[model samples]
Target: RMSTISSAINLPTIYALSTPPGQRSAIALIRVTGTQSKYIYHKLTGKEKNPVPRKAMYRNLYMPGSNILLDSTIVLYFKAPHSFTGEDIIELHCHGGRAVTSAILNSIQALNDMENGIDIRYAGPGEFSRRSFQNDKFDLTELESINQLIDSETELQRRCALSSFNGENKVMFQNWRQTLIENMAPLTAIVDFGEEIEIEGMESILNNIKRDVLKLKKEVQSFIERIEKSSILQNGIRISLLGKPNAGKSSLINSLTNNDVSIVSSIPGTTRDSIDAPIDINGYKVIITDTAGLREQSDDIIENLGIERAIEKSKRSDICLFVLEADSSMKIDESLNKLLLSKELQDKKVILVVNKEDLIINKDELRTMIHNLNNEMKNQYPILPISCLNQCGISDLIDLLTKEFKELSDTSDGADPIIMSQRVKDILINDVIFGLNSFIDCLDSDIDIVLATENLNLAIEGIGKITGQVVGIEEVLDVVFANFCVGK
Candidate 1:
């Protein structure tokens, strides 16, 4: 209903350039939408008749309250409710000069200000899309779609955005929700309209509800899990390669990218800082980093900063690559190895990569030793033997990283959607979901249960964000717009 009203607003005087700024195009288009759109149009057009929607007609654009020429242009008008923003919108073909565009915009601004407020301010980033949601032409899921599309920089994120934008998440979630609601009827009726409940009937209803909830819960959990696990890795899985100096760390990076991005040398501490490159892994973006080889050292300021950055990067990375030379049968240096094995960085996202297979004299011994080490550690540590010079086993390494990152989304684990936004997720889990938990108690109670209704009402406030159900109605203009950029 609110959507219908906002749609009725006629943006009557909305304007935005259809193309991004600074493009070297032969012509530029400035578009306008709203009820006053025709007013803006006629003021400049100086003619009563206009070109039909989708058709370009040549005409001279005029200044308001004056016959002065602004530009000789082609104009097209789209009637209400059928165009973007669901309002009467117009497009003008004008010369692609900054001065000309600004002149026309300034003239329109002056005319619009005479009435009350400027007809349009620079359409705030994503304002057009937001207005579409306000007008009810699109839903919350679709709103996120525009965001996802804008944010997508790789195959995995693209698929995620595309899938959800195409209504994969919406259809799946809504269907499951509807099924839960349908199954809830039998159990809920006991409280809603029950006389003296019979034991067998009550048991059957409880059993049915339990079964349905468990089934739906499993689906929801897995969906959320998969998205969560894959979200970080999907955007770009951070893989940190850690090792003592000259464990072929630089060689591995160069081999993967097939470029000499990092200097490869047999010298100890060849790389003091972490070097990173983005490569597609299993069709997902994996940001692989070659960190400074771990060593006991303290001297140069620049080198110290590099080591510090490497440590910080490793700490935040989704996965760590523990690189060990296959030729080195000597035990790992105690202190340095202990730091790597500590609980702080251990338990997950760490792997034992045995490098320099071509230089290994006894591959059999290294394999047995690595196997024994794994047994003693009792971790899910994978020992992969490879020669960085030969580029062997790198694909397997990437494949393993991709699998682990994808599993992080663990939708089967039953987390509510992998709410990415800290603000949104916190509101849902800490605020809204907690409220839902309390409201569940009301479902089985016999009191007026106004609290339950209230909780349900409050849940609408949060869920409304997901579905955009209450965007501009119950809410004031409290929506602080975001400037979230892609590949951050």
Candidate 2:
């Protein structure tokens, strides 16, 4: 059954457009991978002569079983064992037009039907990447890195993904695995051959193993933490504007995004739901949300629901901008105080934004209000006085946000590679850590040699799973590759 499933997964031939679809552009790439890639290329191009491997050739694509030209394209061929997916691969770089690209793809399909019958088919999501994985071209980490690179929208994200794709994490995991196996060798030898072996410095060896295992565990923990923080950098940081009615939350969002993403009005409760806008602030992606204004009393059911949603948004946000009108009352309400001080929101970063600062008659009064609010909070939360209407102090606010984001999310200098996928995290925690713990228990407890060796083997296998040295369960592979796009 397993062999059948594996065989089904490793289809004979597959093709996909390696580029995004759209109107006419400079170029579009279509990739094919299989043992018969060269044959298919010859048939499609109607060229009797074989093209040199790894060299680009200009050719005219023709309709299958006809001399009608589809499009003039650049073609390249890669032979088996030296190409992506470890198969004979063909890449067609054609003029990027809806009609031309589609016609070329259809011609390939037609040729497949006429010659190979159902052997060639359109590639599924991540199928090319999965094939590369199955063929030993790259490991799971590299495959995941490729996916991350494709999905990356920020500079830091791209750098991290590129580093992983270059096998930084794989090399780290491999070294750890090698160290583990070497550590386990003495224990295995002692188990296989009794005291006759007369192993020297057994105590020292065991102590070294223990220290290494502890160090590895700490490294894994650090990787987990870094990945968690870097995720905020990858997915834009969420900052929600939360305040009372007409506190200039919408105005601030509009100013920040430089567009009327949210409706601004003098009347309260104009924003009945959270409106999110993603803006690039100093190259960092910041998702600023304009949430509904909080109020104690509302006759409208929708307004009450909006207030509840606003509270929820504030609780979940990475940073809460508590906007208060400087000219009006600067008191934080009981409900707002309760929400801010709640355990759920205690760890969240708070920035007290005193809006409409331009309208303030007395600067000392504004400072006094901010001081009182800080005293009530019992913490020195950074306060910024800004006029959302007049665009005053906007640059300072942006600089503050950028600094916070960098402190929280920057991982460029870190040596440890980040683990992006939750599946990888689960394997590391449940399998790798569990195995290490089991092995360590055997060493510390002076358990039977056989049991210790068995636990050590389990630990080695767990490390193998991380680097795809040992193919994981089918479900795990599915979860890992499911995030990839069809062409990847």
Candidate lDDT (C-alpha), each: 0.58, 0.73
Output the worst ten-in-a-row residue range by lDDT, candidate 1: 294-303
> TM-scores of the models, in the given order?
0.69, 0.81
Off by over 4 Å in 2: 1-11, 21-27, 52-56, 79-82, 95-99, 113-119, 194-201, 259-274, 277-280, 283-285, 288-312, 328-342, 361-377, 410-419, 471-479
Worst 10 residues of 2 by lDDT: 260-269
Clashes per candidate, residues 3 or more apart or on different chains: 21, 0
Give residue 136's error in model 2 in angstroms.
3.8
